[model samples]
Target: MAWAILFLAGLCEVAWAVGLKFSEGFTKLLPSVFTVGFMLLSFWLLGLALRNLPLGTAYGVWVGIGAIGTAIAGIYLFDEPATLLKSVSLLLIVAGIAGLKLSSH
Candidate 1:
């Protein structure tokens, strides 16, 4: 359950990140509002998960998920480069996250 909440928090992290881009320097009202809303929600859930999870592992996993999700979203939404190197790097991040998860027990 904690992992599930953490994963959703990670998704919210992605939401706010993309929201930051769409918010257009906070000039756009709706996206800006959403960006701020999701940011708080993300932090709330992260804090909840941290109560039960190890600080280093939870924070690293949260960041790893956010980084990978945002990079993928950027590729599709912003036409960012989709080079082989980028793909390999993302896989490495996933591997690290998995390693952390497996070692957490």
Candidate 2:
């Protein structure tokens, strides 16, 4: 299904985002390669999903997923601050993504 592909793409977005931290400005060879690979795969999946999903809905959901996932990764992996406001904001993004999916045909 297109939604499933889109969801996978969103997950890839998260992987690549975390990969960037590991890549260290692309100075690390293995991590940089994996990051680039994930980036390409994520875009490719998005393209496939676009065949059936609306651009606005797909893009918004993809971005929301990446944002939320990366933020969580940062909090857990990098000791990034996890304030109350940040948590609430992430929840809001999740709600928006759910609303978008429900509203889409």
In terms of lDDT, the best-performing candidate is 2
Listed per candidate, the RMSD to the true structure in angstroms reads: 0.6, 0.6
Model 1: lDDT equals 0.95
> Which segments of model 1 are wrong by more than 4 Å?
none
Per-residue lDDT of model 2, residues 4-93, tens digit only: 999999999999999999999999999999999999999999999999999999999999999999999999999999999999999999
Q: Model 2: C-alpha RMSD to truth?
A: 0.6
Q: Per-residue CA lDDT of candidate 1, range 1-105, in tens?
A: 878889989999999999999999999999999999999999999999998889899999999999999999999999999999999999999999999899889
lDDT of 2: 0.97
Which TM-score value belongs to model 1? 0.98
Clashing pairs in 2: none
